[model samples]
Target: MKDLSYACSKFPAVSDPTADEVRRLRAEEKLSVRQIRARTGLGRNRVHELLRGVPPPEWTRRPNAKDGLRAEAVELRGQGCSVNDIAQRLGVANSTAYQWIRHLPLDADEETAARRRAHSKVMTDARWAAHRAARDEAQAATHRAAAGVVGALTERDLLLLGAAIYWCEGSKSKPWRRQDHVQFVNSDARLLGLFLRFLETCGVDRNMPTYRMSIHESADVAAAEQWWVHTLQLPATRFQRPTLKRHRPTIRYNTQEEYHGCLVIDVPRSRELYWRIEGLVAGLGAAIT
Candidate 1:
């Protein structure tokens, strides 16, 4: 490279007060470039170019905001501090902290521990994945085991089960009303089918039971009526006018596409059958005890 002194001397120096005066004000007087220009009556560019070769005063070397932090990060890293530890203590971005000390060598033990920790994390993640797969397999196996325990239900089993179910869900005789009508209302298709089988077993005419659907006004009434008719295998004439319930402020979760609404099975003039079901429930309760 050309000598800086020789190259600097080539540029024409300002006159009147001269380049030495600008350098003197900048160094000894500790004045800024603008202050030097104002004090010496020289243009900003003239003063700046004149002082270009001159060594700046201590005040001119403005300390970077991160200078102290960078030094601390380097020192701390040499003393076994990790990047995260240095960043937090020095209040610098983790990436900036890493850049300050990444070239430094760590102690042998610290380097070994860092490698082991990284390996441990990978091992832990693999073990957790395996555990999750095993848990899913176990849950599926449990469901299959439980399903196998409950085999097909016999006719007698269904009769007892239906009677118990009807006792829980169907309308019963109350002291105030004295009504013993065989009115079974349910939303479950399986329960309704079993109840239909129960009615058949009792020698009741399937056509005699008048069907009605109780549903929200917002629901597809015609679709629900058709679904129930198809599901129950009943004649359209046997079905009565459906009862539409007014919409509440909060609707039910059953308002989805699969919701066909509750079916009401009313067997007219079945006071005797109602009494027999009540007796059957009573006998079942006594047997269980």
Candidate 2:
């Protein structure tokens, strides 16, 4: 037997200050990885190597949001959830979910496996249903909040809104040709009403618009005409002959009871109105720029 004390005395153990500080920070001071990194100016990889076999303090282990998610994943795994099941329930990626609960063994017989699958299916369906309900509620809440923001529309607001819509949906005079007059067409009844209100706001109360219907030839044209006349309180004689669109079987069009096709509103001597809308639109563009 060699005397280890005599050999050790000949070759003395060297004291490492970096290792000593790392150990002191980890053991005595109980500093977190981030704190130790800042204090010692050590790279993350070096710190991790130094931290081997030393479990982090309980505060570090539990306080993180990711740790909370991992805990939830472990709980779900215990309840017989697979990796995909955990991903769906936690709104996490399947890969991330797998890493969280990989150590947990799924010990089950064939019967238990089948039972787990059925439970997973039921839970998946329930999760989707709940998600849809929550999404609808969030959408409705956002809509109501936005509607509340617009308590009342002044004339200026209507002018701006009307100009934008007309630019989008109405006839605009092209440089190659001319749109000539202010003409708007749309299938949305509420939109048509808003345009009319916009016209009234612009003091075009006397120029009663001649309504035109552009309906599918296959549709009952008379029924749609009568509905539009009654709905818009239009004088029966003011409505022009409807332009029929030839139906194609390849492209399916709405043939529901509520389908009224589209309405075309033409104003007489609306050259001034056209220019006004153009100016408003141009002003809007300039204001944004």
Candidate 3:
């Protein structure tokens, strides 16, 4: 590299370029500040100050109307005009408007600020309570609606529905000790009936095996089994024993109580049937969408 001092001495410095010219050259030619400084032999700081369109440090400083406009910007922010809107009204950039308004409080007086904060707290509380109430009501409505439809399924219907539910959602395969026995495990007795109806639709034999119940460890396992046996008119010998999973505090087992657990249905020839059912589901989705 050439000695910068010698280069500066060789080229006598002219008046600094105008800010408009600097910006235009930077945009059109994509020249760096260092490149401009090297070519003109101007000091790096001087080049930067010129590029920014600010006066050099030697120039006297004075607060002007622009400072007053910043105060107006703060007032407008308190009134809820967004930074972009304020910038447009003041003929300044959005970033400059934001910088002016960021430190100012939303309310000018202590009383007004406190009142606004209190109102915000009340509104937040109301919203949360309303949300929780709505969620509970919706869950109750679902339970009621499910109850109405679940009581009418016959034993054959239950078996077929259970089979279909298993085929769609359960883990099953011939290689994995062929789960040929049909079992419908659910905490909700009503939903169990619906699942059994779905099984009947799929043509599963009702007499092949009796429906069994399984629930979370926290639930009344024996009571749940008895409910299933009595509701379905199955003999005690036909009722398979219920399995209870241990409860963990961190584990979210909402489905264990509410949703019917995976139904183990007897599908003696399930490989081809599984694919057919999958294709039917895919076709239905495509048709509906």
What's model 1's overall lDDT?
Answer: 0.87
> Candidate 1's error at 185, in angstroms?
0.6
lDDT (tens digit, per residue) of candidate 1 on 1-289: 6668966678766564587788888778888887888888989888879999877777767789888888878889878888888889988888998899889865557878889689879998897998889999999999999999979877777678778889999999999999999999999988998898888888876788999999999999999999988887877888888899999889478888998889999999999989989888989989989
Count of clashing residue pairs in every prediction: 0, 0, 9
What TM-score does candidate 3 get on C-alpha atoms? 0.35
lDDT of 2: 0.88
RMSD to native, candidate 2? 15.0
Identify the superior model by lDDT, candidate 2 or candidate 3.
2
Global lDDT of each candidate: 0.87, 0.88, 0.62
- Report the backbone clash tally of model 3: 9
Model 3, span 74-187: residue lDDT tens:
879978776778999999998999899988766668998789779979998897998889999999999999899877757555445554555555554367585433333444
RMSD of each: 22.0, 15.0, 11.8
CA shift of 80, model 2, Å:
30
> After superposing candidate 2, which stretches have Cα over 4 Å from the reference?
1-131, 251-253
lDDT of 1 at 207: 89
Sort order, TM-score high to low: 2, 1, 3
